[model samples]
Target: MRLLFHVQHFLGVGHHRRAEALTRALVAAGHTVTVASGGAPVPGEDWGGARVVHLPPARVEAADFRTLRHLDGTPVDDTWREDRKQKLLALFGDVAPDILLLEGFPFARRQLQFELLPLLEAAKAQPRPPLVATSLRDIIVFNKPPKRHEEVLDLVNRFIDLVLIHGDPALVPLERSFATADRIPAAKKAYTGFVAPVPPSTPNRIASVVVSVGGGAVGKALLWTALHSRPFTRFADQPWLLVGGAMMSEAAIAALRDAAPEGMSVERFRPDFRAVLAGADLSISMAGYNTALDILQTGVRSVLIPFAEGGETEQALRAQLFAEAGRAVTVDQAGLTPDLLGASVNRAADLPPVTLDLALDGARRTVEILTAREAAR
Candidate 1:
């Protein structure tokens, strides 16, 4: 099957990463995949064997997530939106994919409705329309008005053939977050276990503490707090690594480097992040979807401060589930203090290996679902 997948990540790269995992699985299963990305390009993302198409990039600089700009930092207008929409429609015609997989469409990415809604219309108008589906994470940021849910329901019931929920329902079901999820017909919904990459497990482990901020755009508070809390923990004397993403300002990175409390290293990126987490004695970070999945795969002792600003509730819900399962220690992002973070670190360090009874083959399961749907269609 030829699969054309579209994904856009405004703040964190978790959404893109999840799409990457799914496309990789599709490629490995002998299906061709073309990933159309509209978010600002990630420097060294691995997409297995799938081809990539980067649209006119747009990103959110503020936590509000309302203002969007291009990679050149110019504000996006109707012209850019039309250009991107045309590009996506052209790609659809070129690929003529059997499966039109959108990472977040009517369910989220409401800002891009101008582009996606048109693309959806184009796909349906094709000679033989592709199997339209939306690939979503376990949770989403949905504190909007009632009409938001109504719009999603209308689109999904009208166009989408499948709604793949990439999560284990036993941990956090869709209804727990999406109020209108129950209204989606059962045949249109499927839950693939959490999509995660398999990191290399080594013969030995590193004793250092690993702290990472996904995308590093909204993590200055957490990063600085980690530095201040270092001296209060048992691992204070041990080496620590602080990884900020490309989105972090150079000034902030430089300041973090300048203010290092002695045994901590600061950098912009780490290609082997999963491997680093697997070796770390302890890890501290925000509870973004991909980061949380890495902790789950590595079973690293972790203190998760879910990013809760700008009406984002996905990470908070994930942190809560991890706390309930004893997987990690969760902290309040708004009331984050050095002492508070230190205490959670101490508690997480003493817990047993973070074990999960949930299935981690969401990537594979997603591929199966897509192929089955395409065959049946």
Candidate 2:
């Protein structure tokens, strides 16, 4: 079957990561999958067996949606959206998907891309092809007011075919924010578990500690603390590994590398992140969904420093949930210093094991669910 996957999240990597895993699973199942994304195209060589199309990237700020400008900061208007919608219809016409899977923003986009629903409706009306489904992570960061929530509910009720929640709903329910959370009708909702790839164990050297700030976008402060703060006051002598995500510029990476402690090593990006993860005795990271899940799935002792900006608290909330469960440690970004980061890392390192065997199977379950839906249709 031909499948189409859509995702747009400018704030974090959660949406992209979930979409990537699902598309990979679909392709592995012998289906042709096309990814229609609004973000800059992922490095083409890296997409691996799926057709990827890029539309202009966009973001919602202060309740107003603006088209992202190129280097000059010029405001490009709604024409970009119109162009993308036309491209999507043409692509769908040419590829003819048997299933259409959308990720996030139905109730969350808050009318930022209200046109997406109409496009979906148009797709459904064409040639009677493809089953429709919407996928979401376990949490939704409610950055707007009650009126936006109402708009979200209205969109979800009218267009979505199925709801695929990536995390266990028992732990985090998406509907609670809506006054009519329980009343909103969905085609079906299932917890597919957390989608994380397992790290291989065969050839890497183990490290005393691993530190990473996801994609290096919003966690610069955490990296600075982890590197500059002395975390080894307890151990007296433990080496640390730092992974600055690709988003960090070379100059920024160089400054961190130059200031590194005698036993510490710093790199811009690690292609084998999971393998690097496997070797760590302890990890220091921001509490992004995929990063947190990966650390938990590895059952590693770690310190999670959540990056809190404005009123968005998704990562902070997620970290708190895990910390309460005795699985990880959380440090607030507000007062978090290198000394505090070190202390938290040490405390987490000393804790007992947190099992993650069940969480690692999220991707397979998601594939099973999507495949079952296709079969039923």
Candidate 3:
């Protein structure tokens, strides 16, 4: 089967990592995959075997999203949405994949992806490809009542064949995020277990606790608290590693590097986060979908600080849900303090780790949904 995947999120790497995991799963299950992204491409390497196409980058904060802006505060708009969709259709015409998987924003991107109309039309015209699916994580962060929810719903109603939600319903409720479950006409929604990518190596020895604020775009409060807290060295033997994401300015990185604590190590970024995560005894990080799943997958105890920005508190809610279930600890962004973070980190280290296998079979599950739809056709 041939599959096409799409995802966009600029504040962090959650979208890219999740899409890459899905693409890897599909290709590993013997399907061809291509990723068309509306976000700036990461500098290195192809994801699994999936071919990637870069479109205009999109950024999200809380629940609202828009085209990336220039330093001059101008919103970047290139008539590229249509151009990319046209190129996507041409690529679809070439391989005519068995399925097309849209990652976030098909029923949620608002008016940004107006070009999806043609792509939807092309998929409808195809005789062999019987399924068009949309994949999403457990939670979605939206601030207001969806402004154009019904319009996007119409497109999904008309074209989508399946919805693959990557989360356990027993834990995080999808209804809190996406309220359209009962409205879709011709699609099926399945709650796949949390999809997490496994890191290559499991470290033999554990030393310091690792704290990360994913991509370091937001949630500096968490980092600041974790860094400034004096009790962090209570474990005196256990040190700390802080990862500042690519979005951090050189001056900021230099300042952070300069302000390093006795046992604290600071860096701009690390490509293989799984390894970093796997080696850690404890994690202090923001509660993004991919990062949360990675921490859970590695069975590392964590003190999660969810962003308090405008979005409907998806991460905050997720942390609450997980912490309530004994999965991990939760710290709110507004309430975070050096004392609070340090104490939580120390206590979290003593908590038992829940070792969930990080390998997600999203591709095979996706193939089953797609091929089954085709066979029924």
Per TM-score, the best of the predicted structures is 1
lDDT of each: 0.86, 0.71, 0.68
User: By descending TM-score, how would the candidates be arranged?
Assistant: 1, 2, 3
- lDDT, residue 250, candidate 1: 94
Report how far off residue 349 is in candidate 1 (Å). 2.2
Greater TM-score among 1 and 3 belongs to: 1
TM-scores, all candidates, are 0.95, 0.89, 0.85
lDDT of 2 by residue, 116-135 (tens): 76667776687775777777
Clashes of 1: 0
RMSD in Å for all candidates: 1.7, 2.8, 3.3
TM-score of 3: 0.85
Instruction: Tell me model 1's lDDT, rounded to 2 decimals.
Output: 0.86
lDDT tens digits by residue: candidate 1, 227-253: 999888888899898998877889999
